[model samples]
Target: MTMAEKATDQAQRNTEIVLTAMRELFAEKDITALDRYWAEPYVQHSPQMASGLDTLRAVVPDLEGFSWEPKRIAAQGDLVFTHSIVHGWAPNPVVIVDIFRLDDGRIVEHWDVIQDLISAEATVDGNPMV
Candidate 1:
């Protein structure tokens, strides 16, 4: 394969890793995904989460009625970003931009921007949060 093709393939793999990890952790509430996809010394930048995968293993199963709907994803080089809507962790649905950094196909770092999904009526421009 050409260099461009190889890059594209790697990007796709990275994106899939992010998506599958999310599905396993959030949708399935399976901690095994952490071992499968997360690297040791995982760096987390989300204010809500501590800087390691162990915290996730402790927290996910207790989340009542949690649901994740991934709206979009993109990947470049070693980074993947996912835009998703999550429910049950907060009073209102949250829109999140989750960025993952991977090395050798294992996620090593994460950062996220999360905001409560505002109602369409609350928006001055009438734009949806999704």
Candidate 2:
């Protein structure tokens, strides 16, 4: 395949990997998916979580009512980013952008920005925050 074709293929695969991992871990609440997709020394940049896959494995099960609905996803090179609406982790639903870096098909690093969802009335422009 051409270099451009290869890059596109890799990006698609990486996006799929992150999407599946997120669905299984948060929506389905299947912790074992971490073993399949997460690297041993997983680096987490989100302030709420610590580095390491063990930390994630330890926290997911107790997260009652947790759910994630991905609005969109994109990928470039080794990085995949997703915009999602999440519930049960905070007092209100949250909108989050999560970035994952993958190596050899397994996620090795992560960074995220999360904000509580606000109603359209709450926005100065009155635009819905989806």
Candidate 3:
């Protein structure tokens, strides 16, 4: 394969790994699994809270049955953008747009915007916003 093709393959694999890890972490609430995918200096930005990895670790326990499904993903160079539907108590289905910056195959930074999916008008094509 060409260099560009190889890079694309690597990026796609990395994205899948990240997504899978996130799903497992959410489903099982296993904070220790985070170390396998998240960088030491990871930063996360959320609608309700913006904090570092430690704070997120602490706050995860308060959340009940959090889960997400990625609707789309786009990646360029070191950055990957994912649009997903997040489900939890705060909102039945929250539309979330997350941007992840990866370094050395690990997620080092993340920023996200979450909006509650209330009425059908809030989405497009009669589907939840993602």
Candidate 4:
């Protein structure tokens, strides 16, 4: 494989690692993977979450009714973006686009854009959000 191909393969693997950990952490409520996959100076742009890996670990289990499942994931270099469905987080399901910056195979920074999945009646366009 070419050098670019190798880099792409590595990036894909990194994204896969993050997605797998997210599934385990969110769906299974397993915080054990946090320290292993995330760094101490975790920068969180989402107003709902705090910084630090410890904070995430502490907060994960308390999200009793919420389940975040990744619908699509893509990565380039050290950054990975995932579109996910967040069920039970609100009265209606929410679609979230989460972006993460990874270094040395661990997550160092994060940001997200979340939107409530509006009802069919409320939506103007006849298209699904997620």
Clashes of 3: 0
Q: Model 3: which residue pairs collide? A: none
Q: What digit string (tens of lDDT, one per residue) describes model 1 on residues 35-126?
A: 99999889999888898888888988899989988898889999998888899878889998889999999999999899999988899999
Q: Cα lDDT of all candidates, in order?
A: 0.90, 0.91, 0.76, 0.84
Question: Candidate 4's residue-wise lDDT over 1-130, tens digit each?
Answer: 9989988988988898788778777787878888678886899888987888877877777776888888888899999999988987667789999999998888899999989877666778867776
Native-vs-model 2 lDDT? 0.91
Q: List the residue pairs that clash in candidate 1.
A: none
Clashing residue pairs in all predictions, respectively, total 0, 0, 0, 0
**Candidate 2 worst ten-residue window by lDDT:** 64-73
Better of 1 and 4 by lDDT: 1
Which candidate should be chosen as best, given TM-score against the real structure? Answer: 2
Give the Å error, residue 3, model 2.
1.2
Better of 1 and 2 by TM-score: 2
Reference-based TM-score of each model: 0.94, 0.95, 0.82, 0.89
lDDT of 2 by residue, 36-94 (tens): 99987899999999999888888998898898888888899999988888998888899
Off by over 4 Å in 4: none
Model 4 residue 94 lDDT? 93
- Candidate 2 runs further than 4 Å off: none
- Cand. 1 Cα-lDDT: 0.90
Error of 4 at 120 (Å): 4.6
